[model samples]
Target: MQTKKYTRLMLASTLVLAAHAGWASDEGTLTMGTSVNYSSGKYGTQTSTDITSIPLNVAYDKGPWTFKVSVPYIRITGPSDVVVGVGKTSATTSTVRTASGLGDVVTAATYNFYNNAEAQFGADVTGKIKFGTADSAKGLGTGENDYSVILDVYKKVNQLTFFGGIGYTALGSSAAIPLRNVFSLTAGSVFKMDEKNNAGFAYDYRQKSSATSAAQSELTAFYVHKFDKSWKTQTYLLKGFSDGSPDWGAGVSVGYAF
Candidate 1:
């Protein structure tokens, strides 16, 4: 969701500059950011698990395209069956232990292919790859690459912007841990409070990626503030409605543009 929101902001900025010189920009933008996220849940288990991650992200926006990368440091305290982001796995052990190490690395590219300023509508296509950089022995991630693609669209009316997206993911699998491909959906709206501040809420749903896991449904509320053209920050809180999601989660991020 964080990455998707960034793409939306890029589109909005592109629209603002469109009248000056077409839809694509003459000068590219580079952005960097970091976020800290924490989540805790039982995930259909008898004991609760806690997960924390701090990720570094960077992006380059040129013309109507955006390229991004993210790498994270993760800490987990849970049973062996619980996987970060993926929830319960097929492991039969219930032993709880703490582990900390590098997490998976994700890369993505987004292309804005359609825009109508007068009608206040825009759309983008994005493809992502998640590399298995995390240590599978420690259960940080599946030691195989995963791929996904998404289509996002938005419309603006007055002080509000409505957005939605649909995506499909091809999960990586191994003989010991077979996985399932799944579809995901997201929808949300942002209310502009002023030139520098805005708040929004989003709902996300995803099909189960493993037979042992339940489908995921989560809702998040977020606020973003811009201090200047080159600096901004965001904070969010989320609640889960299914065992595949965290019972509750919160995160904060700060970004700089160059």
Candidate 2:
């Protein structure tokens, strides 16, 4: 019943947003990317999950408003329990299961609420929705929708940019477990080394999703390079600090803009 209600709301919201997209003046950009991630000891358990995903994303930016959407095809190899917010059930003889299908779809809209050119400061308000498109039977996702609102602020000084954000997520409940709404925080800074290269690091903290789960904390370092005005690539390494997070992971993505 809750899922159905959320589905209806999502559809209505999509229609309204699509209407706005249709009236937008600028041409939107489309990006395609693929990445692979491997993790061990997730959710404080001795289990591993490996995923290779291809994401298709589209974004439109005009004036101070930006709208974006992403849909990803994911292939997962691991125990089903590991993917569904449940820890490993056994230390031995736990057969590895593989699932491949569409992952969740996400939509976001952001408005620049404040900006100061001289001070090189700006703030944005963003709203996001994550639709449960992955199959629950395959244990690829929670099979419920999620909504989030975030406030982001950034300041630029010379070749360095600093950013931070705070957000709250309303996680949808599933039959197996009821998830709690959680708050999240992130802070990061990027340094532009030259016209083609940049590096940055970020720290993220997220509240626990389940009653018995630990909160999540992770640190990430990323490098980005631009081949030209239309092509770019980025790579990142992450280290998790809590049982609810992956031990370590890495991924790279290539993007194109027009």
Candidate 3:
């Protein structure tokens, strides 16, 4: 009886935590989600759990182009970047504040470069833009314009799929950003979890380009569940390495199909 109860609890917990990210299904539909993030390292050590936001998104997959837009509302508590000198010793600290209102936005235009029955590759020109917010108590943002060129490739074998991408972002304007020329690589597998439902796990790694001495990296694990034939929900956990950004975060999202 104890073993059965433990199994039931674990299964229940997974069901409730499963979610989706990055992509939503819709020709022109919109969706939203919220997440809590933490940051640690040279600059500061902090945690922001009440950051509520939405992924205002629109997607279209047409003959040759797949267009996507993902913009979010964000609020985070972080340490202020400052150096304090006491006598002959100086210490640096990060200030904490509440950043609110409109947040970072991303738009992308992707074109298929190669596609066969089991394999495909594509390229995307993506833009990352930041909008000003009223909550300046916490460095709401550094108004900036950034662009990335992504090369994506994917393959399907039996019931498993492999996908990965490498992208480079050119950062400029506003505040000093750590990520420039970022490269991402991801791979995952899918299984028929239920007779009518599908489930899978994927792992992803990202490295960003930087002018600073230290750079940042991200490692993430994800699980996706499909409801019905056209909808999917997923959950993900991310860990950032190096510094210059958040330490850890988690999120969930829902998607619809047309």
Q: Highest lDDT: give the candidate number.
A: 1
Query: Candidate 2: minimum summed lDDT over ten consecutive residues — where?
Result: 1-10
What lDDT score goes with residue 77 in model 3?
A: 38
lDDT of 2 by residue, 1-258 (tens): 011112222222222222231333445454444344444445554456665555665666666677777777767677666553333322344457889888778788877777777777777778989888878778667788889998877777787877877889898886665678888787777777988887887777778777566777777777778899778777777777887666776666666766
Model 3: which ten-residue window has the lowest total lDDT? Answer: 82-91
| lDDT, candidate 3, 1-258, per-residue tens | 001111111221222212111222344433232223222333233333233445555555554455555555554433443111000011343445445566555566665545564232222333333233223334434344556565655554554444555556554433333334455454444444554454554444444334332343445455566667566666655565644323555566666656
Tens digit per residue, CA lDDT, model 1, 1-258:
122222233333322222212344549888898888788888888888888888888878788787888888889898887877577886465789798898888888888788778888888788988888888878788788889898888788888878888889898988756788899888878888987888888788889888888898888787888999889888888788988888888888888989
Clashing pairs in 3: 19-234, 19-235, 20-234, 79-94, 79-95, 80-94, 80-95, 169-181
Runs in model 3 deviating more than 4 A are 1-52, 82-91, 118-137, 174-214
Ranking by TM-score: 1, 2, 3
Better of 2 and 3 by lDDT: 2
Q: Best candidate per TM-score, number?
A: 1
Q: Relative to the unseen true structure, what is the C-alpha lDDT of residue 161 in candidate 1, on a scale of 0 to 100? A: 79
Clash statistics: count for each candidate: 0, 0, 8
lDDT, candidate 3, residue 233?
66
Q: What lDDT score goes with residue 8 in model 3? A: 18
